[model samples]
Target: MDAAQHISIYSSGNRQPDYSPLQSTLDRLKKRTEENKVTINHTNTVVMHFCTSSQAVAHPQLSVGAHSLQLVQSTRLLGVTVDDRLSWKQHVINIVRTASYKLYMLRRLKSLGTPAKELRDVYTAFTLPTLMYASPAWSSSLTLTQQQQVERTQKRACRIILGPAYDGYDNALTILSLPRLSERHREALGKFGRGLLCHPCHQHFLPPDAPPPRCATRHINKLVPIRAPKTDRYKNSAIPSIVHMINSV
Candidate 1:
């Protein structure tokens, strides 16, 4: 099985993040691969440096043996497009493009007099999954505009299904017994947040449970909130957003 590995180094107060440690780690990984008689797929190997700073900085020159790895502004890992800034804009664009193309196929099926029920099934089976894929990871990071871009695909699908009696996006969803994409995202995020609380491995990712209130306050069971994030991108990330959701509930 092939897997992508991420190595992160955080910057301290007012200090520039360093790449030397990352370079050393990659050197060791190359050595280990050679020792184990495993070949590195240099063509597929690339480096991405994530940062929210506006100041221009030097890109790390990373290598595996004699070959220098390519530095990409964005890359896809396990179907999620992650960019250097972690804004999730590119990821949303890619998924929207893909779901739109699938809708074209759905339009063809509709023209052939496919049953409304069957068309809905085709959508639920084929297209909805495309939009919801890995949604829990990036959904929290989406801007209002990006969220609408995603929801428009579903709205278009509803129009394709309902034809003349479409009425509106909301009524189409209600008539078809479908929830809004934003609602689905909230449910997905909530479910994922609850799962993290129970999951043995991922539970550690959450903040420690709040200590009991001295006077038995109503908010005794919430998880401690994390330190304030320096960037909005980090503030709206899956973990932080989910943590806030869990705490509120």
Candidate 2:
């Protein structure tokens, strides 16, 4: 599916302090739906996620019309599991667990005497995407443990394809001609930033034009810069860091 198909949002924050503004936002949404003759299934209740370090503040109950939404600590959006804290630990763990299972299948294929090239192709097709899916959007926020978890999966795949003899992570990867997981993630972020400038829908997110390039070769368009939000835990989790780097270049 296209990226736009996976977009998700909430009317407003679910915290007590946000109740007044949330109510107003909901009212506007309700009005727009009514005016557009759109139907909302009240049976499908809203789920709220609040990312907070403090456990002292209780989350207040919220409602849209008669439907009372459930407050959740984490929820799945698109294919990623997002925890309220934005740590992405759960998402990383989930993807790694899934990729591990695929690794087992790859091992079985290796036992069947699958050629190294075919095994590599199968791993790239089935397993690599799972570990790196939407990674550019989340990789920068990953803790070292999470990063290791992802890298371990790739390392295992490389071992499976190259056999137990080349068990060293670097050796297996070298035989496979695969870069480190961190390098792949960095490249993905760079490509994502470039893509933003190519897509019309994301143009508004770009900053103002850069000053004229010093050379004709550097005349390619540049992304606008956005300062990272001071309070955001996933400070570089999404667009800002990518755009920041692009603009700096």
Candidate 3:
């Protein structure tokens, strides 16, 4: 697929009542796609998920090459399920559902007298990845209940791997050399911040720092953006969390 052919538009707030611009843009895209010999599959449904904080606004009737796209409550984008609210609740729920099923399989294996090392390996290979996949992007938005739900999955995995002797969840995690889910989320955000500092593409947005000392052969300078005024939580979550973590260090 030609990367340039894929276009995405983001509109914010419920106050804007105009839809003329969006309709016009879609019309141009439809015409361009036709020029590029792209055929629209009218039989298939195209979903347009409108994300909002409150009740949905009225969407203008939209059609592309004889196919009218339907507005949906939620949709999957690049493997993550994004809902209308942008709360990430749906994504978290879906991950928990998947992790719970995986835990069931792990518990069954445990009953079969599987070795602790092997079970730990399985949990690390499967369950942890599921819980932590793209977590830095969504973890900050999770509610207390949702965070607990995700944490419980890991706690269970730790218990299974550490055997029945460990008395507390903390102890089990300590023995496993693992941090709590929340702490891990912060760590991931910190790492992401450092990665951005090291990348040339992000240098434009990152605040500049003083020049390195003359004696210092190598200087590691951490650059983080100043926090903007608080507004909507879901908007630009990753960068702000990254900034917070970087400033703390």
Candidate 3: stretches off by over 4 Å: 1-7, 12-14, 41-56, 204-228, 232-236
Q: Report the lDDT tens digits of candidate 3 across residue range 1-249.
A: 743333455544455567666668777877887898886554343445464537656665667756787777677666687876667888888988898788876788889998877887888888888888888778877778989988998988887776676579988777767789888887787777676766777644445662222335455454445556466573346766666566566
1-249, model 2: which lDDT tens digit per residue? 322222244543434455656656666776786897765554454555564746454565666776776777777877878876767888988999999988988889989999998999999999999988988779877878889989988987887888856668887787788889899898898888777666667655556563333346847656545655776554566677776667667
Write model 1 residue lDDT over 1-249, tens digit each, in one string: 756554443333223657777778877888998898777777778888776678876777788889998999998888899998878889989999999999987799989988778888999899999899989899988999999999999999999987887999989988888999988998999899877776777777777763332345554346778798987877888989987897787
Rank candidates by lDDT, best first: 1, 2, 3
lDDT of each: 0.83, 0.74, 0.71
**Which residue pairs clash in candidate 2?**
207-224
Global CA lDDT of candidate 2, please?
Answer: 0.74
lDDT of 1 at 8: 41
